[model samples]
Target: MTDATALVQHLNSDFSAGHDAVPARVNGTASPAIEQALAHPDLAEPIAAALAYAVVRARGAVRVAELGTCPADRVRPLRRAVERIATERAKAEAVCGPLRRPAQRASHRLGRSLKQTPARAVLPAAHRQTLVTACAELGLHADAFSVPNQRNGAWAQSRGLFGSVPSEAVRELAARDDTEFVAALLHDARMAEDERLGHHLIVERWNRLSATALAWGPYAIANAERRAVSRPLHARRDVLDALEDAYEDLAVLTCRAGEAKYRAFRLTCQVRELTVTGKRASVAAAAHRRAHELLQVSHPEELAEIAEAVRAHQVDCPFRADGCPDCQRVVLKGLSGQCQEAPGSRPEPTSPPQPTDASGPGVTYASFGAEERYAVLNDIPGGARVVVSDAAIGEDSALCGYGWAAEDGTTGHGDSMASTSGEAEIIGVCAAALTALTTHANDEFLVLCDSRQAVDAVQEVEEHGDVTRAQEAVLFPEAGELLTRLLPYAHRITVRWLKGHIGHDLNEAAEALAGLALRQARGRIAERTAHRARARTTSRIATQYLPRRSMPHAA
Candidate 1:
């Protein structure tokens, strides 16, 4: 008869004996127990026997389906954990390889000179994307790298990576549930690309595979499921490369942001010197050095990227600009500086909301763009406008007991503006005498410290009323002694401490006067220039409250 009759006959024969002697398989081979004993190897015989006895396992189809949903749901996280790692890997690989033709060409030339190497797993989303990418370009398989771990009974992760559903998985899931196809198709259109893939394929795969594993008992399922859920070795490596590339944009952007901020901060501190010296060379040098440090930290994984890309001959620039040798392109270089053309000849195209790496340190799309980053740097060192008045500089002895009021000389001395000079009266002199000039200057007046250490030494000298080795040569000026006598009159004198650049009209006036006096002291007798200085300082008063970079554009 047919195989069915034979299987029937065997089961009937065994059942005829007793339930305890149930046939392990429907087929008339060895009894399940005998086979389990003879197979010697563990579990193989049992799983084989259990499935073979499924005829005995036959149950209402409805019941089986109901049970299916439970186990399958349990295994969902494990599968998802695997796929998430894959998507990021792919993005990183795309960036590192041939984003531009010239880069591609260079990669190709370099590849020829080098031996093939293995690829490593990379994530464009992580800190080491560049390194991960370079390994990918060199035929190295970066994505193959994964260290999986379980969390909770239901969830699992690989590489601290999330689980994702790819497009193929979605198709598989949809095909299995054709009854829901129309609804899913409609939903797919409204979903994001990754989310669409996730709902159909990723969720479906997880539901199916995990349920399958759980049905066989979670223990057995877990043991065998490793292979079923694993990323294909080649695909894994490819994904890792993509992941690394994802962060390339970020890596470059972060370095750029950091370097920009560092330079901006440095500039704000030394604007006076920088403007006067016209030495922008140090800015570039510092930028380059800072960029390098950032590369070391943010792109540790990308150290060999250039060399690897080169040796693999992966570089291909469509612009044909790659062919222009450095010396050959001197005329061209004048027009385009730096690489004759970008590593790729991508014509600069204006695109809405231009895409940028979401990876850099201070690179926020909303508030932390290049401009804002510079502002933060500028804030690092404070800038202020102040009215500094020294009594000796006034016109008392015409030489010694003099005070220079900012803009005291705006009109005469021919309309050439200069600081006002005045002789201090005895009362003013009494307040200044026996005083620690530096000490009183700082304590009585808040100095926004151009340097943190100027007055302490000066202040300490007179606190003990003792002159030091340095002070022995010059006696404390009478003006300082007078200040010591009448410091209590500070409430009367009204020495106001103003923040730098704030719109305090007096501060602006004082600063303007100071500038005018300095110019005058240098023997410049230009009246128009002095008047203009006051206007400039006044104009900037409004900008004092805005961040440094914004100062130029503040209302």
Candidate 2:
């Protein structure tokens, strides 16, 4: 039979006779993956057919054969059965408007199935018709209410009078079509937990019907206008002048302060803003073009002329004159502070070393080398003092240490920690900061840390009240907590970044302490690991054979 004729014959058959139809999951809750599959345009026909079957079963109007039914009982007529299913689907399409793939159809039967699913409480046929009519006038399809799993509670609650809606409220809502009915229904429900639901119910239905039409209408015109004005290359001076005059004309037409006037004002402001941005962009582009031209000129004389022109136009040269080979030959002649293009080509100037009172009596760090650069730090009369910290990570363990040098002399501390190198650095800093705050109450604090990231994390906590930059520096949160608690005690707290492994005495002392801590942490980790291995071996040996005392009695 032809497809059309088969469809008609199926509609004629009695769909309400059978009682074995598969009911789809109530409320159309298809999994995200299945919904994505159904949304494919190629699968729409099969999906639609499935939904029609589901709808018919839900309506108590028809039933199809159960899965794995005997051939003898199900072998009546294959052609007639196909036609019946098709006709029922056609009826569903007429009521639901159109079933788009990806959108879960309330009638989808392939996913979850529940036995004896509860039906929505019935409204009078007349009231239902009235609601559908009101919805159509507001540009919504009636099928939106019936699609997917039935939301019976919402309907029942909205209607208010159990099992039926009052004639008076229905009349009042129907008379006002612009959002009043749905708003009243939502207010009655008091569903403040998710405010978007009411908006979604109304907006999705309208959007489905209007999206395609609007794509080529006002949307297209607005996009074209925005592109012309927003791009530096596309915006012409003449065109912008014309727009200014046109804006004035529009303002004259909408002189009153209402929606139209407000819209015109906003449009005028956007155009003016874009014009300023476009002019700046044009200037930058011209500068780039001139730089490209200058870069191509190999001769020093020609390049000099180009550079002069660039300066006359108040544009800075893109290349550094001291560093660029071409510019260096012409522009940087006989300048005392000129940079050498290549390293070691010229001797760079250095400042004279400052005088120090290292001869004053003070305690010395054993870790410092005998070289003069590693001079003993004298006890300086000041409100603040310095502390240096370091951390080292090994293959099996990590550790940290800190050393403080104040007016009294040098004092050091070290400890094993279960963390990476970065965390160790931060923890070391935290230890030093804590010691300084507690020991020197009336003095300012200066902490020097080796790890740059750790130093930044500490500063971040001091400034922002949080550590956001360094993720590897795990001890930052603890450091932040300690700093926060110690803020009241210290006169002033400062964290500084210092290069590691230098000849600085305090830093060298901290390095030695950190190495000692790393060795201790590694030994502890090894001992624990060996203990666990031995325990496991002993347990296995003991369990290999059952005890004679615990054996079951012989039968």
Candidate 3:
């Protein structure tokens, strides 16, 4: 049998069993037993086995369609197969978790192989003729030649990394006609060549354009579902060498991206210091030590370039380049200076403590034994204050709350009925700092917190300027979003460490608020859980006791 016929036969045979088990529907409705079994892995074996067969059928169709040797009419059956598989996977996600990734992988393999195929096999007649004529004029063989295979492959790889073509790029392509699509792609190809850039550099520029026709848009040649190519891995030596090259490229790029991000964040801190305080920011000896440890760099010289850039910006004073040349000279001279302080020796509170909100009726704050004096440096300028914040989680990992107290007797706290302690900790600190920053935008603020993880998360945001990095590190996701919102006001913010329950006044007060918040949150959670249980009991009783026709309608 031919490729299409063989694919149809495989799909038919594989899915022949349980033909009536799931009705063909796009509504994503399914039987409760099947749904429950799919979601719960202990009950997944039966459904997983059934899905394995469907996966095989769908993947095979995609593969044969991609090979380019198949007839054009075969596209119809292949499209239908893809749709059916997608529908099935959509309905199964209640149990299957994520099946689309496997389907996407199959498509990627197809797109990557298309580049090595002849243009006549991959492109339609008009476009193929255009390419053929152009090739003849350029003194290249029409029938046997590939179309810029290296850049095309690189674009394909970038698409695979990004997962899909961006929507804006797709919308731009939608405005263009099919012939223009090919013309625009060729135009970009010529531009890439004229620049004399390597394949990866050209591809990176194309990817960054976001509006370029060569972008993997719906009608673009580099479309992940259409024309593309990859080298065959059957040649062991070539494949191995290619793998090594790719690994090296990826590793170098990852390192550079991280290093650049770190340097950018540090420079931002320095700029904030100069702009806000009219003097250099004091660096904590330990904070720098921690940063170096995380970066895994032995020499400080790796950081010197970005540090110099920050100093240059301060000196050049682009915002006031001509008017304050003398001011710039003084600032540049001071940029080389640092006032290092020993760890945990932050400035002491200048203002007296305000009384705690002890009369709140719902929950009582937990008091840590007796208040004791902790040594704090008295070096901070008159008005600057540290906000000591902390998060508390209940035993069942359900209830969470965070609280903060500024050295000037300004205190605030918030609570949530759900989340882990780590999540709660970061949220508490970030949420507290966000409120404080909004209230005091012009004042310098330091966030003192007890959770090392939470402090590190804030540090990550400071060093990388990516709050979502915390969520990517599997810290709290909500905390990441909150931190992202706080970025605009970051110039005035600093986060530092505080030892928990050590009898420092603001730290103790913040702890009390955190504990109280946790208590209140747990009570709220308990009420909700009880309410849900009661509702479920009522539902079961009504279902079992009442006649089907007489059962009360659900609101």
Candidate 4:
């Protein structure tokens, strides 16, 4: 059997036998290897705690498995129990100072006899204080546990004193084949305690260097190069080879960062294409996962620029034809060629634009069929028409707009000038619901909106059944007004949250309409401002140089 397995069996037997002195005896008397481990002051408590915790966890796992729980589900309760015990121990230590070393106390008392001692007699003054402090903190009376020989009942009942070990450390220890599993168990204990035992400094320094080298950024290459040139040589050939492998990974990452970015962009495009074409959810999700993996190592700003270029290409060249110059430019140069400015004079791109209107010529909106609607509104009565609403804010202007599209092909959009996107979203949902009420007053309407805040606000009003209170609590007067108007129709309207920018057909259409409305509103504002400017200039010139007849001869 593995050392860990044997240790578990030994602990189970000792605990089952109700031996008050097992905590002390198990460390040294169980096996020669364990005895040698306990000889080190740093390893004693950690080793004992690790063994006890492992036994408790193994027992719990076996119990849970017999109840037919899955592996993932089985781990949660054991983890929670370990965490609880650790928290309690920390609190107790904070109040009464740390628990006395049980192994040391037992050794001094036994004096080579190694006979079983009553657990109550074994408790040092500090341990008693800890138990009392723990009980007081938990609001339990201390007098209930004055029994003569209850073998450290509190510690045993709490399943030992160790904290949880991270899965990464556990997996790494398990992967090593040269050492006994007991050594792995010792390593896990030290890791959990976060104690700096021998060789810890070397491991910590190497980890820091590896993290810096692997972190993808401007300094990654330099850090990798420094480590490759200056890393300390180890006596073991295997350790040296491991360092070499890490250096190679860093080298590969640094050398291929640009290529990775390009591949990520292509993958993103593929995912978007698949989503917009009404492909299977699983297929689109898989593509998205692949794209996300590549995105992790890429620079955020670079990815944003590429995404913007792709979006612009989708907007300007609706066909997205392979041969189109703009499409080719986006693919080859990673920049949109739509601007007339020379390459040197072109302004650096800003933040990515919001999702554009999908109603544009080349963009296709995926259908949200009956199956999708049913999935979202399984509780709501059937045969209700679906309306998806979205809002957009101008990038450079304060202009905002709301758009909504019904599955019945009815669509509406309007600008809410000088309002924030949050207010615009509520206004959009209100407008969509009101429009639906006008057309199909008797029909139930399910409004799928992207803004959770808006949905929550509406639900709040419904729950409280007070429009005046909602008006007082709302941030924007316009939103309050729109919501008040839709309040009476609340029974017919159901507002549900839908994630924005995914390939939902009606939602995309609404998003596109909202964006289009904002752009048009911005254009109109610009036109009106230019007209006033021109008129003012004309009047100024007339007064200065057009021979203004001395203010009409003072008439």
Query: If the candidates were sorted by their lDDT against the true structure, best first, what order would they fall in?
Result: 4, 3, 2, 1
Q: List the global CA lDDT of all models.
A: 0.30, 0.39, 0.44, 0.45
Model 3 over residues 1-555: C-alpha lDDT tens digits? 765444334433343322223332222565554333334433222233344334333443543344334566876777676577556654554553343333322321221111111111222343345545544554534531232323333333332322334455544653555446444444433332222212222333333332222212212211111112232324233433333333222222222222233333333332222221322112222222332333224324423432454455555566454433223223323332331221122565788553232233322123323331221323334555567788886531234667776654456667653245666777877887888766765777777777777777777887788766676333323566777887776667777555677667667667776766655443332435544543443344345334422422322
Residue 506 in model 1: lDDT? 35
lDDT of candidate 2 over 1-555, digit per residue (tens): 865444333322322211112111122454443344434443333334344434322221111121112253453454344455556556544543344321222222111111000000111233235435544554544632332222322342353313343455344443544345334332322223222222312222222222122111222222223333344433344443433333322222111112222223233333223321343334323332332333334234433443453344323445544323233222323221322232114555789544333345433444335532333344323545566677665431122333333223334455534245566677777777777666655667677777777777676666665444444355324444555565454337677666566666556656765655444332322435544543443343234322412322111
From the highest TM-score down, the ranking of the candidates is: 4, 3, 2, 1
Q: Clash number for every model?
A: 85, 6, 7, 1
How well is each residue in 358-419 modelled by candidate 1, as lDDT tens digits? 23345333454532221212222133211222222211001222111111111111111111
Q: Where in model 3 is the C-alpha error above 4 Å? A: 1-382, 417-419, 472-476, 524-555
Cα lDDT of candidate 2 equals 0.39
RMSD of every prediction: 34.4, 32.0, 27.8, 33.5
TM-score for predicted model 4 compared with the true structure:
0.29
TM-score, one value per model: 0.18, 0.27, 0.29, 0.29
Q: Is candidate 1 or candidate 3 better by lDDT?
A: 3
lDDT of 4 by residue, 130-184 (tens): 4455445445446322321222222222332223333565445334442243333
Measured by TM-score, how close is model 2 to the native structure?
0.27
